[model samples]
Target: MNLIFIDSIWFTFMLLPFLIFIARIADVTLDTLRIVFITKGNKIIAPILGFFQILIWLVAITRIMKDLDNITYYLAYAGGFATGNYIGLILEEKFALGIQMIRIVTQKDASSLISNLYEKGLHSTSVEAKSNQGKVHVIYLIVQRKMIQNIISLTNQYNPNAFYSIEDIRSVDVQSERINTKQKKYRHVGSEK
Candidate 1:
């Protein structure tokens, strides 16, 4: 304590950079998730994640500023940021936490697909729209994010050559509140008869 200064050569060159690297990784991962939560309209969790993210960020930046001449710190910070983004995306995909809408545009009939969806307790609506090619059935449905693969499989089974797009459902009304709770007991389980 009396002889060696707190910013010793070993600490500045080795330990400090390592600590900064780890801190940056944690901060950026939390930041990525925080942004996702915000986009998903999660009011409570985003701020909590933001709080921890910034706290770790401040600690890391303070270290970076103290050793501005060191290039190792910069490389570590950048590498950590990139790695954190990759990990965060993987985690987000694994979580799959939201509702989505799948729209299938097919020139063929959608009755079979609709029936299959109904059997699976999923609701679907079909509209006969005139496309440039011919009449198309624009079949659409609200689906939980986890069931997206199943929906794609069913569409492939029913409409072999169908064009489909999936979109995030940002909000739902009181009528369809079941998307957020009690998915199994959703009162309106099937589309219009």
Candidate 2:
């Protein structure tokens, strides 16, 4: 039984494809994270992730090249790529690595929304502008990416008719007023898993 498992067509077709599939999932997931880090302006982590992504990719591709005629390997590779994209996006969301700027425009009085934000320990800038609608209050908040949904909830609760847009902030002057000075240790997420 040991000999059969060690040297058999079962190992070549089944175990080999499974290995390739797992490897592709890992490498592609790493690639996705690397891209996210790059866009976030993280110079150190991006390159480290990229190195492992390419390394695993080369190993997986070499195995597939050895058995080009095998349909199972192709299926595994394609499936892993697709699944990796989904899993990578989920992981990035979980990591929530970066800052976001949210711009909110409302026709209603923004005092309630501003108060809600302040109560939540979030700082925002509000300006009164004249639009075709006569007057509008524009509020801008810069916060960590993870806090986006909570902020949105506050806006929806206070100003249901508000128009809000979110954008990724590539860089921000940390020394400026209204920016949170507390240091967040993001490395905990990566090391925990």
Candidate 3:
């Protein structure tokens, strides 16, 4: 009986650190994502993530408090935090949840680039502007974050030396006509049935 009791105690001591490590990683990852959502002005999802982040943190801290003398638990907690940050950044990159505004200025003729963008269904506006070097064409395009790479490729193909800058767009007001048209089509299909 004494041997069994000792074995159980040893098992628990070994298991608690691992469990704490996992919990810390989870909570920190959620925290990182929550910050991203907040910056992107995602009111609904940000609060939900924030709630869970704090809840998990409370649980992990409670365990640490319970065993103040455990060096292994502290190390696990710290290690988890470091690993969580790396994982969170990678996940955010994979998600690419937002829009970006890309501005391109080219000294060369921009007609071909503009035409290619229109052909690819990427809307852009071009303006004739003058620079110290002479005439320059400025093109402005707003696209989903994931589409930035494609835009870059098109720019490189058209004007490799074009000057371009990307800025994060917090929000965009899309025209309601597109949504209404889709709804009307759906209604028409349903009526036919």
> CA lDDT of each candidate?
0.81, 0.85, 0.80
**Clash totals for all candidate models:** 0, 0, 0
Candidate 2 per-residue lDDT, tens place, 1-193, comes to 4987856888878998899999999998999999999998999999999999999999999999987998999999999999999999999999888888999999999998787676556788999999898799999988888877877777887778889999999989988868742324222211331
Ten contiguous residues with the weakest lDDT in model 3: 181-190
Q: Write the per-residue lDDT of candidate 1 for residues 1-193, one digit (tens) a residue.
A: 6347556888777877888888888988899999989998999999999999999999988889886999989988998888889888888888887788889999998888777777767767789999999999998887667778767877887877999999998776637732432255332323333
RMSD of 3: 6.9
Alpha-carbon shift of residue 27 in model 3 (angstroms): 1.0
| Shift in Å, residue 186, candidate 1 | 11
* Candidate 2 weakest lDDT stretch, 10 residues: 184-193
Model 3: lDDT equals 0.80
Which candidate number maximizes lDDT? 2
Instruction: Show model 3 residue runs off by greater than 4 Å.
Output: 1-13, 176-193
RMSD per candidate (Å) reads 4.5, 5.5, 6.9
* Deviation in Å, model 3, residue 86 alpha carbon: 0.9
Tell me each candidate's TM-score.
Answer: 0.84, 0.89, 0.84
